[model samples]
Target: MRKIIVIGSMSIDLVVSSSKRPEKGETILGDNFFTTPGGKGANQAVAAARLGEQVYLVGRIGDDDFGKEIYENLKDNNVLVDGVEPVTQMPSGTAHITIADQDNSIIVVPSANNEVTIEYVKKHLEQLDSGDIVLLQQEIPSETVAFAIEYCDRNGMISILNPAPYREVSNQVIESATYITPNETESNAMFKGNMEDALQAYPKKLIVTMGDKGAIYHDGNRKVTVDGYKREVKDTTGAGDTFNGAFAVGLQKEYDIEKAIAFANLAASHSVTGMGAQGGMPTLLDLEGEWHV
Candidate 1:
Protein backbone atom coordinates (compact mmCIF):
# COMPACT_ATOMS: atom_id res chain seq x y z
CA MET A 1 0.00 0.00 0.00
CA ARG A 2 1.20 3.50 -0.75
CA LYS A 3 1.76 5.88 2.16
CA ILE A 4 -0.70 8.67 3.03
CA ILE A 5 1.17 11.14 5.22
CA VAL A 6 -1.08 13.55 7.15
CA ILE A 7 -0.06 16.83 8.77
CA GLY A 8 -2.50 18.45 11.22
CA SER A 9 -3.72 18.43 14.83
CA MET A 10 -4.94 15.74 17.22
CA SER A 11 -7.75 16.79 19.58
CA ILE A 12 -10.26 15.48 22.05
CA ASP A 13 -13.76 16.72 21.27
CA LEU A 14 -16.62 17.11 23.72
CA VAL A 15 -20.04 17.10 22.09
CA VAL A 16 -23.33 18.38 23.46
CA SER A 17 -26.79 17.87 22.01
CA SER A 18 -29.03 20.91 22.23
CA SER A 19 -32.41 21.74 20.77
CA LYS A 20 -31.33 25.26 20.02
CA ARG A 21 -28.14 27.28 20.05
CA PRO A 22 -27.49 29.59 22.94
CA GLU A 23 -28.70 33.10 22.25
CA LYS A 24 -26.61 36.11 23.19
CA GLY A 25 -26.00 36.01 26.97
CA GLU A 26 -28.38 33.09 27.24
CA THR A 27 -27.81 29.53 28.44
CA ILE A 28 -29.70 26.40 27.47
CA LEU A 29 -29.76 22.95 28.98
CA GLY A 30 -28.17 20.32 26.76
CA ASP A 31 -29.68 16.87 26.32
CA ASN A 32 -26.48 14.87 25.93
CA PHE A 33 -22.73 15.19 26.24
CA PHE A 34 -19.87 12.93 25.17
CA THR A 35 -16.16 13.03 24.52
CA THR A 36 -14.44 11.57 21.49
CA PRO A 37 -11.19 11.55 19.57
CA GLY A 38 -11.27 14.14 16.80
CA GLY A 39 -9.21 16.82 15.01
CA LYS A 40 -9.08 17.12 11.24
CA GLY A 41 -5.75 15.31 10.87
CA ALA A 42 -6.61 12.43 13.14
CA ASN A 43 -10.11 12.11 11.73
CA GLN A 44 -8.82 12.00 8.15
CA ALA A 45 -6.12 9.51 9.12
CA VAL A 46 -8.75 7.27 10.62
CA ALA A 47 -10.86 7.74 7.51
CA ALA A 48 -7.98 6.66 5.28
CA ALA A 49 -7.25 3.70 7.50
CA ARG A 50 -10.87 2.61 7.25
CA LEU A 51 -10.61 2.99 3.47
CA GLY A 52 -7.57 0.64 3.52
CA GLU A 53 -4.87 3.26 3.11
CA GLN A 54 -1.54 3.08 4.93
CA VAL A 55 -1.62 6.28 6.97
CA TYR A 56 1.27 8.05 8.70
CA LEU A 57 0.12 10.72 11.16
CA VAL A 58 2.35 13.67 12.03
CA GLY A 59 1.11 16.08 14.68
CA ARG A 60 1.44 17.12 18.32
CA ILE A 61 -0.54 16.01 21.34
CA GLY A 62 0.13 16.66 24.99
CA ASP A 63 0.97 13.95 27.47
CA ASP A 64 -2.45 13.86 29.07
CA ASP A 65 -5.35 11.47 29.45
CA PHE A 66 -7.09 12.92 26.40
CA GLY A 67 -3.94 12.58 24.39
CA LYS A 68 -3.51 9.01 25.57
CA GLU A 69 -7.01 8.12 24.48
CA ILE A 70 -6.45 9.62 21.03
CA TYR A 71 -3.24 7.62 20.61
CA GLU A 72 -5.05 4.41 21.55
CA ASN A 73 -7.81 5.18 19.07
CA LEU A 74 -5.29 5.75 16.30
CA LYS A 75 -3.51 2.49 17.00
CA ASP A 76 -6.77 0.57 17.25
CA ASN A 77 -7.75 1.92 13.85
CA ASN A 78 -4.38 1.00 12.29
CA VAL A 79 -3.10 4.52 11.65
CA LEU A 80 0.70 4.76 11.69
CA VAL A 81 1.45 6.91 14.76
CA ASP A 82 5.21 6.55 14.59
CA GLY A 83 5.36 10.03 13.13
CA VAL A 84 3.23 11.67 15.86
CA GLU A 85 5.20 14.04 18.06
CA PRO A 86 4.37 14.02 21.74
CA VAL A 87 4.74 17.31 23.56
CA THR A 88 4.99 17.93 27.30
CA GLN A 89 4.90 21.69 27.45
CA MET A 90 1.21 21.85 26.54
CA PRO A 91 -1.95 19.80 26.85
CA SER A 92 -3.67 18.02 24.00
CA GLY A 93 -5.95 20.13 21.84
CA THR A 94 -9.67 20.03 22.61
CA ALA A 95 -12.87 21.18 20.94
CA HIS A 96 -16.25 21.84 22.50
CA ILE A 97 -18.96 21.06 19.96
CA THR A 98 -22.73 21.46 20.16
CA ILE A 99 -25.05 19.75 17.70
CA ALA A 100 -28.43 21.46 17.45
CA ASP A 101 -30.54 19.36 15.13
CA GLN A 102 -28.71 19.47 11.75
CA ASP A 103 -26.81 22.62 12.70
CA ASN A 104 -23.65 22.43 14.80
CA SER A 105 -21.19 24.92 16.26
CA ILE A 106 -17.79 24.54 17.94
CA ILE A 107 -15.07 26.21 19.99
CA VAL A 108 -11.48 24.97 19.90
CA VAL A 109 -8.39 25.55 22.01
CA PRO A 110 -5.32 24.60 19.93
CA SER A 111 -3.18 23.52 22.94
CA ALA A 112 -0.15 21.48 21.93
CA ASN A 113 -1.49 21.13 18.40
CA ASN A 114 -0.52 24.74 17.86
CA GLU A 115 3.07 23.74 18.54
CA VAL A 116 3.32 21.73 15.34
CA THR A 117 6.07 23.80 13.82
CA ILE A 118 7.80 23.94 10.46
CA GLU A 119 10.85 22.31 12.00
CA TYR A 120 8.74 19.36 13.05
CA VAL A 121 7.19 19.15 9.58
CA LYS A 122 10.62 19.38 7.92
CA LYS A 123 11.83 16.53 10.09
CA HIS A 124 9.20 14.31 8.55
CA LEU A 125 9.54 15.48 4.95
CA GLU A 126 11.71 12.49 4.04
CA GLN A 127 8.82 10.16 4.89
CA LEU A 128 7.10 11.08 1.61
CA ASP A 129 7.93 9.62 -1.83
CA SER A 130 6.70 9.67 -5.41
CA GLY A 131 3.20 8.22 -5.77
CA ASP A 132 2.58 8.69 -2.06
CA ILE A 133 -0.16 11.06 -0.90
CA VAL A 134 0.47 13.99 1.46
CA LEU A 135 -2.63 15.27 3.30
CA LEU A 136 -2.88 18.55 5.26
CA GLN A 137 -5.47 20.61 7.13
CA GLN A 138 -5.74 23.85 9.17
CA GLU A 139 -5.75 22.25 12.62
CA ILE A 140 -2.09 23.16 12.79
CA PRO A 141 -0.48 26.47 11.88
CA SER A 142 -0.55 27.64 8.27
CA GLU A 143 3.23 27.82 8.21
CA THR A 144 3.55 24.13 8.92
CA VAL A 145 1.04 23.38 6.19
CA ALA A 146 2.99 25.55 3.78
CA PHE A 147 6.21 23.75 4.67
CA ALA A 148 4.69 20.34 4.10
CA ILE A 149 3.05 21.36 0.80
CA GLU A 150 6.26 22.86 -0.53
CA TYR A 151 8.18 19.79 0.59
CA CYS A 152 5.77 17.48 -1.20
CA ASP A 153 6.04 19.57 -4.36
CA ARG A 154 9.83 19.23 -4.36
CA ASN A 155 9.65 15.54 -3.50
CA GLY A 156 7.40 14.67 -6.44
CA MET A 157 4.53 13.51 -4.28
CA ILE A 158 0.78 14.16 -4.37
CA SER A 159 -0.27 17.07 -2.10
CA ILE A 160 -3.88 17.22 -0.93
CA LEU A 161 -5.09 20.07 1.29
CA ASN A 162 -8.37 20.19 3.20
CA PRO A 163 -8.65 23.81 4.30
CA ALA A 164 -11.14 23.39 7.10
CA PRO A 165 -12.13 25.92 9.85
CA TYR A 166 -12.32 28.60 7.14
CA ARG A 167 -9.14 30.58 7.63
CA GLU A 168 -7.60 32.80 4.96
CA VAL A 169 -5.17 30.59 3.00
CA SER A 170 -1.79 31.45 1.60
CA ASN A 171 -1.32 31.43 -2.17
CA GLN A 172 1.97 29.55 -1.95
CA VAL A 173 0.28 26.63 -0.21
CA ILE A 174 -2.44 26.64 -2.86
CA GLU A 175 0.13 26.76 -5.66
CA SER A 176 2.13 23.84 -4.23
CA ALA A 177 -0.95 21.63 -3.93
CA THR A 178 -2.04 18.80 -6.20
CA TYR A 179 -5.64 19.16 -5.03
CA ILE A 180 -7.51 21.52 -2.68
CA THR A 181 -10.67 20.09 -1.04
CA PRO A 182 -12.83 22.79 0.50
CA ASN A 183 -16.48 22.65 1.58
CA GLU A 184 -19.13 25.12 0.34
CA THR A 185 -18.57 27.71 3.08
CA GLU A 186 -14.83 27.23 2.86
CA SER A 187 -14.93 27.41 -0.95
CA ASN A 188 -16.90 30.64 -0.83
CA ALA A 189 -14.51 32.00 1.76
CA MET A 190 -11.46 30.94 -0.24
CA PHE A 191 -12.91 32.14 -3.51
CA LYS A 192 -14.77 35.18 -2.18
CA GLY A 193 -17.58 35.09 -4.84
CA ASN A 194 -16.75 32.83 -7.78
CA MET A 195 -15.20 29.36 -7.51
CA GLU A 196 -13.76 29.75 -11.00
CA ASP A 197 -12.14 33.00 -9.99
CA ALA A 198 -10.80 31.48 -6.77
CA LEU A 199 -9.66 28.32 -8.53
CA GLN A 200 -7.68 30.33 -11.07
CA ALA A 201 -5.45 31.62 -8.28
CA TYR A 202 -3.82 28.22 -7.96
CA PRO A 203 -2.41 25.81 -10.53
CA LYS A 204 -3.50 22.73 -8.59
CA LYS A 205 -6.78 20.90 -9.13
CA LEU A 206 -9.74 22.19 -7.06
CA ILE A 207 -12.46 20.06 -5.45
CA VAL A 208 -15.46 21.83 -3.87
CA THR A 209 -17.67 19.65 -1.69
CA MET A 210 -21.31 20.68 -1.37
CA GLY A 211 -23.18 18.66 1.22
CA ASP A 212 -25.99 16.50 -0.26
CA LYS A 213 -25.50 18.20 -3.65
CA GLY A 214 -22.21 16.27 -4.21
CA ALA A 215 -18.86 17.64 -5.32
CA ILE A 216 -17.53 19.85 -8.11
CA TYR A 217 -14.09 19.46 -9.67
CA HIS A 218 -11.83 21.86 -11.51
CA ASP A 219 -8.55 20.71 -13.00
CA GLY A 220 -7.44 24.06 -14.41
CA ASN A 221 -9.30 23.70 -17.74
CA ARG A 222 -12.33 21.45 -17.37
CA LYS A 223 -15.09 21.41 -14.75
CA VAL A 224 -17.00 18.31 -13.61
CA THR A 225 -19.57 17.65 -10.93
CA VAL A 226 -19.98 14.33 -9.13
CA ASP A 227 -23.45 13.54 -7.84
CA GLY A 228 -23.63 12.81 -4.13
CA TYR A 229 -24.87 9.44 -2.99
CA LYS A 230 -28.07 9.55 -0.98
CA ARG A 231 -28.10 8.28 2.61
CA GLU A 232 -29.55 9.08 6.04
CA VAL A 233 -27.50 11.91 7.48
CA LYS A 234 -27.30 11.54 11.27
CA ASP A 235 -24.31 13.81 11.53
CA THR A 236 -21.95 15.49 9.04
CA THR A 237 -18.96 15.76 11.35
CA GLY A 238 -16.45 13.79 9.35
CA ALA A 239 -17.84 13.76 5.81
CA GLY A 240 -15.20 16.06 4.37
CA ASP A 241 -12.39 14.16 6.04
CA THR A 242 -13.73 10.93 4.60
CA PHE A 243 -13.83 12.47 1.14
CA ASN A 244 -10.29 13.81 1.32
CA GLY A 245 -8.95 10.60 2.82
CA ALA A 246 -10.76 8.30 0.40
CA PHE A 247 -9.64 10.52 -2.45
CA ALA A 248 -6.07 10.14 -1.23
CA VAL A 249 -6.47 6.38 -1.27
CA GLY A 250 -7.80 6.60 -4.83
CA LEU A 251 -4.79 8.60 -5.95
CA GLN A 252 -2.46 6.09 -4.29
CA LYS A 253 -4.01 3.53 -6.61
CA GLU A 254 -3.52 5.96 -9.50
CA TYR A 255 -7.24 6.47 -10.07
CA ASP A 256 -8.13 9.39 -12.36
CA ILE A 257 -9.47 12.60 -10.90
CA GLU A 258 -13.05 11.74 -11.88
CA LYS A 259 -12.90 8.22 -10.50
CA ALA A 260 -11.16 9.48 -7.37
CA ILE A 261 -13.76 12.18 -6.82
CA ALA A 262 -16.58 9.70 -7.38
CA PHE A 263 -14.97 7.32 -4.92
CA ALA A 264 -14.65 10.19 -2.41
CA ASN A 265 -18.29 11.16 -2.89
CA LEU A 266 -19.38 7.60 -2.30
CA ALA A 267 -17.25 7.37 0.79
CA ALA A 268 -18.62 10.63 2.19
CA SER A 269 -22.20 9.63 1.45
CA HIS A 270 -21.62 6.45 3.39
CA SER A 271 -20.12 8.49 6.22
CA VAL A 272 -23.19 10.71 6.70
CA THR A 273 -25.30 7.61 7.23
CA GLY A 274 -23.89 7.31 10.75
CA MET A 275 -23.05 9.56 13.71
CA GLY A 276 -19.85 11.09 15.08
CA ALA A 277 -16.60 11.71 13.22
CA GLN A 278 -14.58 8.50 12.76
CA GLY A 279 -17.62 6.39 13.51
CA GLY A 280 -19.33 7.35 10.24
CA MET A 281 -16.41 6.60 7.91
CA PRO A 282 -16.66 3.39 5.87
CA THR A 283 -13.94 0.80 5.55
CA LEU A 284 -12.21 -0.16 2.28
CA LEU A 285 -14.30 -3.29 1.89
CA ASP A 286 -17.38 -1.31 2.90
CA LEU A 287 -16.76 1.24 0.18
CA GLU A 288 -15.93 -1.41 -2.42
CA GLY A 289 -18.87 -3.49 -1.29
CA GLU A 290 -21.34 -0.62 -1.39
CA TRP A 291 -20.16 1.41 -4.38
CA HIS A 292 -18.63 -1.08 -6.76
CA VAL A 293 -16.92 0.06 -9.90
Candidate 2:
Protein backbone atom coordinates (compact mmCIF):
# COMPACT_ATOMS: atom_id res chain seq x y z
CA MET A 1 0.00 0.00 0.00
CA ARG A 2 1.10 3.58 -0.63
CA LYS A 3 1.82 5.87 2.28
CA ILE A 4 -0.87 8.43 3.07
CA ILE A 5 -0.03 11.89 4.38
CA VAL A 6 -2.76 14.06 5.88
CA ILE A 7 -2.13 17.80 6.23
CA GLY A 8 -4.59 20.01 8.11
CA SER A 9 -5.83 20.90 11.60
CA MET A 10 -5.89 19.02 14.89
CA SER A 11 -8.31 20.07 17.61
CA ILE A 12 -10.13 19.11 20.76
CA ASP A 13 -13.82 18.93 20.00
CA LEU A 14 -16.39 19.79 22.66
CA VAL A 15 -19.58 18.11 21.57
CA VAL A 16 -22.96 18.88 23.06
CA SER A 17 -26.26 17.14 22.45
CA SER A 18 -29.34 19.28 22.64
CA SER A 19 -32.94 19.12 21.51
CA LYS A 20 -32.60 22.51 19.89
CA ARG A 21 -30.12 25.33 19.57
CA PRO A 22 -30.60 28.22 21.93
CA GLU A 23 -31.61 31.48 20.32
CA LYS A 24 -29.48 34.57 20.69
CA GLY A 25 -29.55 35.98 24.24
CA GLU A 26 -31.16 32.78 25.56
CA THR A 27 -29.46 29.92 27.37
CA ILE A 28 -30.81 26.39 27.11
CA LEU A 29 -29.94 23.16 28.83
CA GLY A 30 -28.08 20.50 26.86
CA ASP A 31 -28.62 16.77 26.97
CA ASN A 32 -24.97 15.76 27.07
CA PHE A 33 -21.43 16.97 26.58
CA PHE A 34 -18.22 15.15 25.72
CA THR A 35 -14.70 15.97 24.65
CA THR A 36 -13.17 14.14 21.70
CA PRO A 37 -9.93 14.38 19.82
CA GLY A 38 -10.85 15.75 16.43
CA GLY A 39 -9.98 18.15 13.59
CA LYS A 40 -10.14 17.36 9.88
CA GLY A 41 -6.56 16.15 9.55
CA ALA A 42 -6.61 13.96 12.63
CA ASN A 43 -9.99 12.52 11.76
CA GLN A 44 -8.91 11.63 8.24
CA ALA A 45 -5.67 10.15 9.50
CA VAL A 46 -7.50 8.03 12.03
CA ALA A 47 -10.05 6.97 9.47
CA ALA A 48 -7.38 5.87 7.05
CA ALA A 49 -5.38 4.11 9.76
CA ARG A 50 -8.44 2.19 10.92
CA LEU A 51 -9.01 1.08 7.35
CA GLY A 52 -5.54 -0.51 7.39
CA GLU A 53 -3.53 2.25 5.76
CA GLN A 54 -0.11 3.47 6.84
CA VAL A 55 -0.90 7.09 7.60
CA TYR A 56 1.08 10.15 8.69
CA LEU A 57 -0.54 13.28 10.09
CA VAL A 58 0.96 16.74 9.53
CA GLY A 59 -0.38 19.66 11.50
CA ARG A 60 0.29 22.07 14.33
CA ILE A 61 -0.83 21.85 17.93
CA GLY A 62 -0.26 23.87 21.08
CA ASP A 63 1.85 22.87 24.06
CA ASP A 64 -1.30 22.63 26.16
CA ASP A 65 -3.27 19.78 27.66
CA PHE A 66 -5.61 19.61 24.69
CA GLY A 67 -2.64 19.33 22.38
CA LYS A 68 -1.14 16.55 24.46
CA GLU A 69 -4.42 14.70 24.46
CA ILE A 70 -4.81 15.04 20.70
CA TYR A 71 -1.25 13.87 20.10
CA GLU A 72 -1.79 10.81 22.23
CA ASN A 73 -5.06 10.13 20.47
CA LEU A 74 -3.32 10.10 17.10
CA LYS A 75 -0.57 7.88 18.46
CA ASP A 76 -3.10 5.50 19.91
CA ASN A 77 -4.80 5.25 16.52
CA ASN A 78 -1.50 4.23 14.91
CA VAL A 79 -1.08 7.41 12.89
CA LEU A 80 2.48 8.66 12.51
CA VAL A 81 3.12 12.08 14.06
CA ASP A 82 6.61 12.84 12.78
CA GLY A 83 5.22 15.85 10.92
CA VAL A 84 3.25 17.31 13.85
CA GLU A 85 4.62 20.42 15.53
CA PRO A 86 3.82 22.10 18.81
CA VAL A 87 3.49 25.86 19.08
CA THR A 88 4.38 27.07 22.56
CA GLN A 89 2.77 30.48 22.45
CA MET A 90 -0.72 29.45 21.50
CA PRO A 91 -3.37 27.10 22.81
CA SER A 92 -4.43 24.09 20.78
CA GLY A 93 -7.19 24.38 18.24
CA THR A 94 -10.75 23.65 19.37
CA ALA A 95 -14.25 23.19 17.99
CA HIS A 96 -17.51 23.77 19.82
CA ILE A 97 -20.05 21.46 18.25
CA THR A 98 -23.76 21.04 18.85
CA ILE A 99 -25.80 18.14 17.55
CA ALA A 100 -29.56 18.22 17.26
CA ASP A 101 -31.86 15.98 15.24
CA GLN A 102 -28.72 14.36 13.80
CA ASP A 103 -27.50 17.67 12.36
CA ASN A 104 -24.57 19.65 13.69
CA SER A 105 -23.39 23.23 14.09
CA ILE A 106 -19.71 23.91 14.72
CA ILE A 107 -17.64 26.93 15.66
CA VAL A 108 -13.91 26.44 15.26
CA VAL A 109 -11.14 28.38 16.97
CA PRO A 110 -8.00 27.79 14.97
CA SER A 111 -5.14 28.61 17.27
CA ALA A 112 -1.96 26.60 16.74
CA ASN A 113 -3.52 25.18 13.58
CA ASN A 114 -2.95 28.55 11.95
CA GLU A 115 0.77 28.16 12.64
CA VAL A 116 1.15 25.37 10.05
CA THR A 117 3.30 27.05 7.41
CA ILE A 118 4.36 26.27 3.88
CA GLU A 119 7.86 25.59 5.12
CA TYR A 120 6.53 23.05 7.58
CA VAL A 121 4.65 21.20 4.84
CA LYS A 122 7.66 21.27 2.52
CA LYS A 123 9.90 19.85 5.18
CA HIS A 124 7.53 16.97 5.73
CA LEU A 125 7.34 16.26 2.01
CA GLU A 126 10.91 15.02 2.31
CA GLN A 127 9.61 12.04 4.26
CA LEU A 128 7.20 10.97 1.50
CA ASP A 129 8.20 8.78 -1.41
CA SER A 130 7.24 9.33 -5.00
CA GLY A 131 3.67 8.24 -5.82
CA ASP A 132 2.65 8.51 -2.19
CA ILE A 133 -0.83 9.85 -1.53
CA VAL A 134 -1.09 13.28 0.08
CA LEU A 135 -4.48 14.24 1.49
CA LEU A 136 -5.30 17.84 2.46
CA GLN A 137 -8.24 19.84 3.82
CA GLN A 138 -9.24 23.49 4.26
CA GLU A 139 -8.86 23.62 8.04
CA ILE A 140 -5.29 24.88 7.68
CA PRO A 141 -3.79 27.83 5.79
CA SER A 142 -4.84 27.99 2.14
CA GLU A 143 -1.40 29.12 1.06
CA THR A 144 0.19 26.08 2.64
CA VAL A 145 -2.40 23.87 0.96
CA ALA A 146 -1.69 25.45 -2.39
CA PHE A 147 2.01 25.02 -1.93
CA ALA A 148 1.63 21.40 -0.91
CA ILE A 149 -0.55 20.66 -3.95
CA GLU A 150 2.02 22.17 -6.31
CA TYR A 151 4.83 20.38 -4.54
CA CYS A 152 3.05 17.05 -4.87
CA ASP A 153 2.47 17.70 -8.55
CA ARG A 154 6.18 18.32 -9.05
CA ASN A 155 7.12 15.25 -7.05
CA GLY A 156 4.95 12.77 -9.02
CA MET A 157 2.70 12.17 -6.02
CA ILE A 158 -1.07 11.99 -6.04
CA SER A 159 -2.62 14.95 -4.26
CA ILE A 160 -6.23 14.91 -3.08
CA LEU A 161 -7.75 18.13 -1.79
CA ASN A 162 -10.88 18.17 0.35
CA PRO A 163 -12.22 21.72 0.47
CA ALA A 164 -14.29 21.59 3.63
CA PRO A 165 -15.58 24.35 5.88
CA TYR A 166 -15.93 26.13 2.52
CA ARG A 167 -13.49 28.91 1.66
CA GLU A 168 -12.24 30.71 -1.40
CA VAL A 169 -9.37 28.82 -2.95
CA SER A 170 -6.99 30.05 -5.64
CA ASN A 171 -7.19 28.74 -9.19
CA GLN A 172 -3.62 27.57 -8.86
CA VAL A 173 -4.58 25.41 -5.93
CA ILE A 174 -7.58 24.02 -7.79
CA GLU A 175 -5.55 23.12 -10.85
CA SER A 176 -2.63 21.73 -8.89
CA ALA A 177 -4.66 19.06 -7.17
CA THR A 178 -4.95 15.65 -8.81
CA TYR A 179 -8.39 15.26 -7.24
CA ILE A 180 -10.76 17.71 -5.54
CA THR A 181 -13.40 16.31 -3.16
CA PRO A 182 -16.02 18.83 -2.22
CA ASN A 183 -19.50 18.50 -0.82
CA GLU A 184 -22.51 20.31 -2.28
CA THR A 185 -21.91 23.59 -0.45
CA GLU A 186 -18.20 23.63 -1.12
CA SER A 187 -18.78 22.76 -4.78
CA ASN A 188 -21.16 25.66 -5.10
CA ALA A 189 -18.72 28.00 -3.37
CA MET A 190 -15.80 26.95 -5.56
CA PHE A 191 -17.62 26.93 -8.87
CA LYS A 192 -20.36 29.48 -8.21
CA GLY A 193 -22.79 27.29 -10.18
CA ASN A 194 -24.40 23.89 -10.35
CA MET A 195 -22.60 20.61 -9.62
CA GLU A 196 -22.52 19.74 -13.31
CA ASP A 197 -20.55 22.85 -14.12
CA ALA A 198 -18.10 22.15 -11.35
CA LEU A 199 -17.58 18.63 -12.63
CA GLN A 200 -17.28 19.99 -16.15
CA ALA A 201 -14.61 22.35 -14.93
CA TYR A 202 -12.52 19.75 -13.07
CA PRO A 203 -13.64 16.67 -15.01
CA LYS A 204 -12.64 13.39 -13.35
CA LYS A 205 -10.75 15.42 -10.81
CA LEU A 206 -13.90 16.88 -9.26
CA ILE A 207 -15.86 14.66 -6.90
CA VAL A 208 -19.03 16.12 -5.41
CA THR A 209 -20.28 14.39 -2.27
CA MET A 210 -23.99 14.86 -1.64
CA GLY A 211 -24.84 13.82 1.93
CA ASP A 212 -27.42 11.03 1.62
CA LYS A 213 -27.64 11.37 -2.13
CA GLY A 214 -24.27 9.70 -2.47
CA ALA A 215 -21.47 11.03 -4.72
CA ILE A 216 -21.08 12.03 -8.34
CA TYR A 217 -17.93 11.64 -10.42
CA HIS A 218 -17.49 13.36 -13.76
CA ASP A 219 -14.70 12.53 -16.16
CA GLY A 220 -15.38 15.54 -18.42
CA ASN A 221 -17.10 13.31 -20.95
CA ARG A 222 -19.15 11.14 -18.61
CA LYS A 223 -20.73 11.33 -15.17
CA VAL A 224 -21.36 8.49 -12.70
CA THR A 225 -23.38 8.49 -9.53
CA VAL A 226 -22.69 6.20 -6.59
CA ASP A 227 -25.70 5.71 -4.33
CA GLY A 228 -25.10 6.10 -0.62
CA TYR A 229 -25.54 3.20 1.75
CA LYS A 230 -28.47 3.09 4.17
CA ARG A 231 -27.73 3.33 7.84
CA GLU A 232 -29.06 4.74 11.10
CA VAL A 233 -27.34 8.04 11.64
CA LYS A 234 -26.49 9.06 15.17
CA ASP A 235 -24.25 11.96 14.21
CA THR A 236 -23.16 13.32 10.85
CA THR A 237 -19.78 14.60 11.98
CA GLY A 238 -16.67 13.13 10.35
CA ALA A 239 -18.63 11.28 7.65
CA GLY A 240 -17.00 13.27 4.89
CA ASP A 241 -13.57 12.80 6.38
CA THR A 242 -14.27 9.09 6.56
CA PHE A 243 -15.22 9.07 2.90
CA ASN A 244 -12.13 10.97 1.87
CA GLY A 245 -9.83 8.72 3.88
CA ALA A 246 -11.37 5.56 2.44
CA PHE A 247 -11.23 7.02 -1.04
CA ALA A 248 -7.52 7.73 -0.62
CA VAL A 249 -6.92 4.17 0.54
CA GLY A 250 -8.83 2.83 -2.44
CA LEU A 251 -6.74 4.94 -4.78
CA GLN A 252 -3.57 3.80 -3.04
CA LYS A 253 -4.66 0.23 -3.65
CA GLU A 254 -5.07 1.03 -7.36
CA TYR A 255 -8.85 0.69 -7.44
CA ASP A 256 -10.76 2.46 -10.18
CA ILE A 257 -12.43 5.75 -9.35
CA GLU A 258 -15.91 4.27 -9.22
CA LYS A 259 -14.85 1.49 -6.89
CA ALA A 260 -13.06 3.97 -4.74
CA ILE A 261 -16.18 6.07 -4.39
CA ALA A 262 -18.23 3.01 -3.54
CA PHE A 263 -15.80 2.06 -0.81
CA ALA A 264 -15.88 5.63 0.48
CA ASN A 265 -19.66 5.74 0.48
CA LEU A 266 -19.92 2.57 2.53
CA ALA A 267 -17.32 3.73 5.00
CA ALA A 268 -19.02 7.11 5.37
CA SER A 269 -22.45 5.55 5.89
CA HIS A 270 -21.03 3.34 8.61
CA SER A 271 -19.44 6.36 10.29
CA VAL A 272 -22.79 8.08 10.86
CA THR A 273 -24.13 5.13 12.85
CA GLY A 274 -22.19 6.27 15.92
CA MET A 275 -21.53 9.55 17.73
CA GLY A 276 -18.51 11.85 17.59
CA ALA A 277 -16.05 12.12 14.70
CA GLN A 278 -13.15 9.75 15.23
CA GLY A 279 -15.12 7.54 17.60
CA GLY A 280 -17.67 6.64 14.95
CA MET A 281 -15.32 5.82 12.08
CA PRO A 282 -15.40 2.17 11.04
CA THR A 283 -12.40 -0.11 10.73
CA LEU A 284 -11.74 -2.59 7.91
CA LEU A 285 -13.09 -5.37 10.07
CA ASP A 286 -16.23 -3.39 10.76
CA LEU A 287 -16.88 -3.30 7.02
CA GLU A 288 -17.74 -7.00 7.35
CA GLY A 289 -14.96 -7.94 4.87
CA GLU A 290 -16.77 -6.01 2.16
CA TRP A 291 -14.05 -3.36 1.87
CA HIS A 292 -12.11 -5.52 -0.57
CA VAL A 293 -12.51 -4.92 -4.27
Candidate number achieving the greatest TM-score relative to the actual structure: 2
The numbered model that scores best in lDDT is 2
Give the per-residue lDDT digits (tens) of candidate 1, residues 10-118.
8998888878888899988988888889998999999888876678899999999998999999999999998886799999999888888775677888999999899
Over 4 Å off, model 1? 199-204, 219-221
Reference-based TM-score, model 1: 0.95
Off by over 4 Å in 2: none
Judged by whole-model lDDT over C-alpha atoms, candidate 1 comes out at 0.85
lDDT tens per residue, model 2, 123-165:
8998788899999998899899889999999989999999988
Per-candidate TM-scores read: 0.95, 0.97
Q: Extract clashing residue pairs from model 2.
A: none
lDDT of each: 0.85, 0.91
Clashing pairs in 1: none
Residue-level lDDT for 180 in candidate 2: 94
